[model samples]
Target: MDLVRIGDKVISRHKIDSFLTEILQLRSMGLSQTDVAARLGIDRTLVSRLENMGELRKGKSVAVIGFPIANRDEIYALMQAEGVDYVMLMSESERWDFVRQKSGIELFNAIMELIALAHSYDQVVVIGSGKRIKIIRAALDKEVVGLEIGESPIQEDKYVDPAELVAVIRAIKGGNV
Candidate 1:
């Protein structure tokens, strides 16, 4: 057990951790704040404040897909940091290699699988040429956030602004857009 000393008062870190775990478990089990507080003999506001402090995003799963991106590594790191559930990013050459490596039937099956997986998420963010984004949006049934990096027939990798993508992600997570 870890101990913390504040002047003459001593606190057990283990006890505090266990208490917090119980509170969160109760909340996850669908207990109301008031009910949890009454059972734990704590204030209702404490439960509310604890939940607010730990909340990262609204309970929605998000997926991000981008291709022929110049800054794929930067965007991939950003997506991981932001807790994006699914990420598919590729450079121009990588995209071509991917297509060239697969047979026609294999490619079709793979695309169908990707679309099926994407349908499981609450929202999808597609970063590509305008036409590709439109096509993806039309295929998906759920919310689709499009970040058009270039016009149709984009042959070269285009750089996407990290700040712009972050804003879109935050808006979606905050239920603002």
Candidate 2:
């Protein structure tokens, strides 16, 4: 077996490569920059820098809009960890109640504000059912990556796969899609 000694310890280059692969996997799994840093005994800023390095464009801005997601909070956390500039994530019950309980100008203003906010981003990743995706795309009138997850008004919160979403984002960001 061959080993290289950089200082006091000897290690295989394969081991270093393997460790790097794990770190990237953990990152893909939606672990926060801080959590990855803690796990790797590295600075959190370094993790942030590594993520920024993969960003397709600087200052182009990305946003996420999803609803009725069962794992809304976790998905939101993942978006933040991935460096999305804006997010409007809500569970099914929360979104329904928001509209159902409001009336007159109250509802109108809220709806308008949300739409206005959604239009601010350069690219928006819309996660919803086939039906909702159509509506969202019509309203936003911007670059959208519509990720359909069946149909909605669903009773259960949809559990989104972080890795799948990450792949779509990477493709969009890298201009591959």
* Maximum-lDDT candidate: 1
What are the Cα lDDT values of the candidates?
A: 0.89, 0.78
The total of clashing pairs for model 2 equals 3
Best candidate per TM-score, number? Answer: 1
RMSD of model 1 against the true structure? 15.4
Tens-digit per-residue lDDT, 76-173, candidate 1: 99999998999999999999998999999999999999999988888898999889988887788655789999998999999999999999888778
Supply the global lDDT for candidate 1: 0.89
Which window of ten consecutive residues has the lowest lDDT sum in model 2?
50-59
- Compute the lDDT of residue 50 as modeled in candidate 2: 66
Every candidate's CA RMSD = 15.4, 14.1
Displacement of the residue 31 alpha carbon in candidate 2, Å: 34
Candidate 1: where is the Cα deviation over 4 Å?
Answer: 1-59
- The residue-by-residue lDDT of candidate 2 on 1-177, one tens digit each, is 657987898989888678767777897777988898999999989877765655544237788888778788888888888778898888878988888998979999998888889888777888889788888878877546777766765566787888888877766666544
- Candidate 2 residues lying further than 4 Å off, grouped into runs, are 1-59
